[model samples]
Target: MLIAQLTDTHIRRPGSLAYGVVDTAIFLEAAVAHLLALDPRPDAVIVTGDLTDFDDPQEHARFRQITAALPMPVFPIPGNHDSSAGLLAAFPEIAGRCAGGRVNYVVEDLPLRIVMLDSTVHGRPHGTLGAEGLDFLDRALGAAPGTPALVCAHHPPFLTGIRHMDVQNLFDAAALEAVLRRHPQVLAYTCGHVHRAVTTTFAGLAATIAPAPAHSVSLALDPAAPPTFHMEPPSLSLHRFAEGRLVTHRSFIGAFPGPFPFFGPDGRAIAG
Candidate 1:
């Protein structure tokens, strides 16, 4: 099963731009086109979060229109920039009414039982998977003990070491970790928030923060350098499930000069 992960899109209305700089909507459109052109289409797409820059109704409407072009089903959860009401209203199909105000859900239709966690701390910059959120996950995992599960959220549970972003990461990963430990069936945790393609471990399980297809966060690790972003090729993550394990690949978005065959006309290696 190939599941494409797109996160931190930060899309805005038709004319608006994210951070007063990025034309996020255009990037999102490019991302959609890129996905549709893939040879082996992904079975599904999980949009980790920050779908909108301001969580505005208009932004959500535009987001829906852009994503509607996608051929595969989309599963979206909330991020710090999003609110439960807005998300639920935006994608009523995916964000179906749940008990709590947060948009937590479980999808068992696919090969992997995906546990969509809500890490958004409404109206705040930081994120957290509180006790109730963890409990919601526990119940979902407990319901299906043997199924391989993938935890999808917006915030990376572990500190990213990027001083600026770490401060706003999921503050209490310990609580979430406790729940994950009990469910050994969970394969990994996939998220986005730092706007970079990152790989790490949390609660003894693999974790991936997919790169944004809109813009990329600077990789500068300088303690004094201010937070910034680069036009560095935006990208997404593709998780392939096989042999009871998951392997992730970073798929950079945008066109480039490539695909020159390795073998020449005579079946000889191209002499550089």
Candidate 2:
């Protein structure tokens, strides 16, 4: 199964720009086109939060309008920039699957089970999977012990060395690790919010933070560096499950160079 992950879209009102700069809607449109053009299109798309710049109903409406072109199922969670109410209102179908007023649910129809968790805390930049959310995840993973699973949330559960972003990362990471450690079926834990592509390990499983299809958080490793973003090449994560393993690749957006041949027409190696 192949799954595409889009995160931190930060969509705003019809013509407003994010932070007075990025036209996030345009970026998202390009991303949609990129996904549609994939040779073997993804079976599903999991959006790991920040569907809007402000948790406004109009912003959410805009998000829905842009994503309507996608034929595959699109699953989304709430990020720090989003609210549970806002997300639920935008995607009413999700409301039936959610419980305890959180957008925590599992996708069971595919070979790779997906457990999407809501880590957003109202009026807060950081994230946490409260006791309720943790319990929900534990139950979800435990239900399918033999299935390879992928856990997704908005805030990355680990630090990324980007000081400003790190401060707003998942706050209850240790608790989350404890829950995940008990579930060996989990293939990996993926998230967004940092707006950069990052990989690491958590609870003995691969963990990733997908880059946004818009601006990227400036790669400032200094502890005193201020929070900033750059108009870097936007990208998204593609997770393919094959041969009992799940692999992720960063698929960058936009056009680049040509697909030049690596060898002559005679089928021999071409020397530089």
Candidate 3:
């Protein structure tokens, strides 16, 4: 199965730009087009978080409009900028699962189970999986002990070295990791907040932070450099599950200058 992960869309109102510069809505539109154009189209798209820039109703409506046009199903989880009430209001189909007023839930419609964890802290910029959240995870993982699963959360559970973004890293990392460790079936912890295509490990398994379809967060490793965004090439991640293994590939959003043949005219290997 091919699953495309688009993160940190940060879409604002139709004509508005996020951060007064990046037109995030346009970025996301292009991203969906790119995903649809892939040789083998994605089975579904899981938007990890930051679906809107300000959690505005207009933004959410626009998000719905864009996604509703897609051929495949798209599942969205709230980010720091999102509100559970706002998200549910925008997509009523999920009201049942989010009835308790939390956005976390499990999706078993696909061959692989998707455990979407709501990491948004109400009115806060950072994330935490409190005692209640942790208990929910334990129960979810326990129920699907042998099923291949992907734990999708907005904030990554590990320090990403990007000092500015690190301060907002998952507050209950230790607890979250412990819960994940008990679930041997979890293939990885997928996240988005950092807005960089990062690979790290949590509970001895793959943990990935998908790149944004909008601006990418600058990869400044210096502690003094504050977190910032740049108009770098937009990108997304493709999580391919085959034969009981999940392989992730990072793909950029725009057209490149090539489809350059890898072989010579005479059928010999092309040399660098």
Candidate 4:
């Protein structure tokens, strides 16, 4: 099974731009096209979060309109920039799967089970999976112990070196780790909100932060660096489940140079 991960879309209303600079909508459109063009298209798309610049109904609607192009299922969770109610309202189909107004649910039809969690803290930039969310995750993973599962959320449970973004990371990570440690079936913990692609290990499990299809958070390792973004090449994560392992690949968006041959027509190595 192949699952495409798209995060931090930050879509806005039709005429607006995110942060007065990025036309996130256009970026997402390109991303949609890129996904559609994939030779073996993803079986499903999991959007980690930040689906809108603002948690506005119109913004959510716009996000929906743009992603509706994908024929596969698109699962989303609430990020700091998004609200649970907003997401539920926009994608009512998922409403029945969630409870207590939190956008937490499971995708069971696929070979790799997906447990999407809500880490958004209302009106705040940071994230946390509180006791309730932790319990939900524990229960979800425990329900199917033999299934290989991937856990997803909006905020990363671990810190990235980017100071500003780190401050807003999932605060209750230790608690989250404790829960995940008990569930050996979890293959990885994936998230977004940092606006960059990052990989690390949490509780001995593969953890990744999917890059956005729009602007990327400036890569500043210094503790004093200010929060900023760059119009870097947008990208998405493709997770392929095979041979009892989950492998992730970063697929950049947009056109680039040609795929030139590495050898001559006679099958001889082409020397530079």
Candidate 5:
């Protein structure tokens, strides 16, 4: 299965840019167009979080303008910048009304179960998967024991070594790790929060964070260093699973200003 992961779009409403700088609406349009142009279209799209800059109702309305109709289903979870109520109010179909429209949800795509967890605490900059979210995850995993599942959220369960970002990571990863250990069927854990393409291992499973679709966080590991942004090409990740193994590829859209041949001199084309 080819699952496309898009995160940290930080899409801003028309005339409402972020930090008086980024034009998220324009970038988001480019990103969505890029995703739709993929050759072997992804079976589904999982948007990890930060769908909007300020989680405003108007922003959600603007988001709908860009994503209202796509070839594949788009699933989303709330980030620290999102409002659960506002998100549901916009994408009521995928938000799935459960426990009073909680953003945490689960979907079984046969042989693969996706557990979308909620980490937003409303008005908090950092994220955490608390008791209720953990319980929901436990039950979701228990539903299909033999299937290889992916636990997805907006916050990484472990530190990313960026000290300032680490301080705001999931507060109960240790507790969540205990639960994950019991469920060996889980293939990996994925998230997006630091606005960069990052990979690490957490709780014995591969963890991946996709790059943002607009900009990148500066490669600064020191806590005292001021945070910075770069025009580095924004990207997304595609996870392909077969034969019980998972491989992830990061694709930077609207990048690489070059023109190559669809077919090589040997009359064989390379697949991107």
Candidate 6:
């Protein structure tokens, strides 16, 4: 089975730009179109978070229109910029089943279960998982038993060592870790808040952050250095499961100008 993960859309209203520069909507469309063009397409698409820039009703409406043409199922959750109530109102189908509450949900995709955790605290740039959220995870993971599952959230539960982004990580991660310890079936923890491709381990399980499709975050390894941003090409991750192993591939949307060569059998090119 194949799973396509799209993160950090940060979509804005039509004709609106993000941070007065980047055109988020256009890039998002390009990213989606690229995914649809993939051969043996993914079974479903899981959008980690930051679905909108302003959480406006119109933004949500426009987002639906743009994604409405996707051939596979698209699952989304709220980020710091989203409004749980507004999202529910915009899509009654998701709202009806989610019960219009916290926006956290779970789906058993068979052979691979997905637990979508809501770590977005109202009006806050950082992330936090309350006591209730932890309890829900425990129960959901326990119910699934031995099925290999993936835990997804809008925020990274572990530190990425980046200066500005580290401060905004999930605050109550220890509590979340305790729950993860009890559920060993979890294969990996996936998130998208930092706007970078980060890989770390939490509770002995792999944790990966998907790259943003709109723009890239500045690399700030130095604590004293100022934060910066990048306007590089957008990218996403594809998770494929074959023969009891899960492999991940990072793909950039546009064709990069530079290139090398294609290898052939016997480590030599068969033709020019």
- Please provide, for model 3 over 156-251, each residue's C-alpha lDDT reduced to its tens digit, 9 standing for 90 to 100: 888888988889878999999889888899998899998889998888999999988888889899899976888888899999999889999999
Two-way TM-score contest, 3 vs 4, winner: 4
User: In model 1, what are the clashing residue pairs, if there are any?
Assistant: none
Please, what are the lDDT tens digits per residue for candidate 2 over residues 1-272? 89999999999997799999999999999999999999899999999999998899999999999999999999999998899999999999888789777999998879899999999999899999999999999999888899999999999888899989888999999999999999998999999999999999998999999998999999999999989999999999999999889999999998879678899988998886
- Each candidate: what lDDT? 0.89, 0.94, 0.87, 0.93, 0.83, 0.83
Candidate 6 Cα lDDT to native = 0.83
Tens digits of per-residue lDDT, candidate 1, 152-236, equal 9999888777889988989878888999999999999999999999998888899999999978889978877799999888789
The 10-residue segment of model 1 with minimum total lDDT is 92-101
Decoy 4 TM-score against native: 0.98
Candidate 6, after superposition: displacement of residue 270 in Å? Answer: 3.2
Best by lDDT: 2
Count the clashes in each prediction.
0, 0, 0, 0, 0, 0
User: Candidate 6's residue-wise lDDT over 184-254, tens digit each?
Assistant: 78888889988888887898888899988888888778887677779876899888876656677888887
Clashing pairs in 5: none
Off by over 4 Å in 1: 265-267
What are the runs in model 5 whose C-alpha is more than 4 Å off?
Answer: 255-272
| C-alpha positional error of residue 166 in candidate 2 after TM-score superposition, expressed in Å | 1.1
Question: Could you tell which candidate, 3 or 5, scores higher by lDDT?
Answer: 3
Residue 191 of model 1 has an lDDT of 95
Evaluation by lDDT, superior candidate among 2 and 3: 2
| Tens digit of per-residue lDDT, candidate 4, span 46-74 | 99989998889999998899889999999
